[model samples]
Target: MSKNILIVDDSMSLRQVVSIALTGAGYNVIEAGDGNEALTKLNGDKIHLIVSDVNMPGMDGITFVSHVKQDANYKFTPIIMLTTESQQEMIQKGKELGVKAWLVKPFKPEQMLDAVSKLILP
Candidate 1:
C-alpha cells in the first residue's frame, strides 16, 4: 500500500501544491490548516509521514512536532518542515523535535519529493 502523508499548512495553495506532488508520486495525502487541526486529524490513522509549516496561528510546527514525538502512536513517524522561515533557531527547534528533514519555502517539488523519498518510513 502507498504511504499516507499528512501536510499541515495554513495556506491552501501550498497544500495543493504539495498534495499534487505526493499524489502524483503514488502517495496518499491528508491536509490540515494548522497544528491544532492536524492533531485532531491524527485520530488512529496509519499515517507514515508529516509535512508541516512553522509559523502558524496556534501550535506552530515545532510545538506540534514535540507533541507528536511524545505521543505513543505517532512518535516514530517521520516529519518534514516545509516553511518560509529559514531562521537557524527555527531549524534547530525542528531538529530537536526529531523532524527528519527541513525544506524552506518556495521549494522545488522535485527536491521536496527527494527528501520525502529518503526520509519516509518503510
Candidate 2:
C-alpha cells in the first residue's frame, strides 16, 4: 500500500502544490485547512506522515503537533513542519513536540520528496 500523508495548511495553493509533489512521488495525500480539521481527519485515517504549517487561523502547527504527541496512538507518527517561519524558537517548539523534521517554506518539491522518502519507505 502507498504511504498516506496528511498535509495541514491554510493555503489552498500550498496544499495543492504539496499534494501534487507527493502524489507524483507515489504517496497518497490528504489535506486539512487547519489544526481542527487535521485532528478530525486523524481519527479516521491511517497516515504515514504529517506536513504542517506554523501559522493558521484556529489552531497553529505547534499546537497541533503538541496534541498529536500527547495522544499515545499518534505519538510515534512522523511529522514535518513546513512553513515560512525560520525562527529558532518556532523550530524548537516543534522539536519539543516530537516533530520529525522541519523544512522552511518555498521549499523545492525535490527537497520535500527527499525528506518524505527518507522518513517513509516506499
Across 12-108, the per-residue lDDT of candidate 1 in tens digits comes to 9999999999999999999999999999999998999999999898888888898899899999999999999998987887888788899998999
The global C-alpha lDDT for each of the candidates, from Candidate 1 onward, is 0.92, 0.91
Q: Global lDDT for candidate 1?
A: 0.92
* lDDT assessment of candidate 2: 0.91
Per-model TM-score versus the true fold: 0.96, 0.96
93, model 1: CA deviation in Å? Answer: 1.5
Q: What is the C-alpha lDDT profile of model 2 across 29-119, one tens digit per residue?
A: 9999999999998894678899999999999988898899887777788999999999999888888778889999899999999999888
* Candidate maximizing TM-score: 1
- Enumerate clash totals for all models, in the order shown: 0, 0
List where candidate 2 sits over 4 angstroms from the true fold.
Answer: none
Question: Which whole-number lDDT from 0 to 100 does residue 8 have in model 2?
Answer: 99
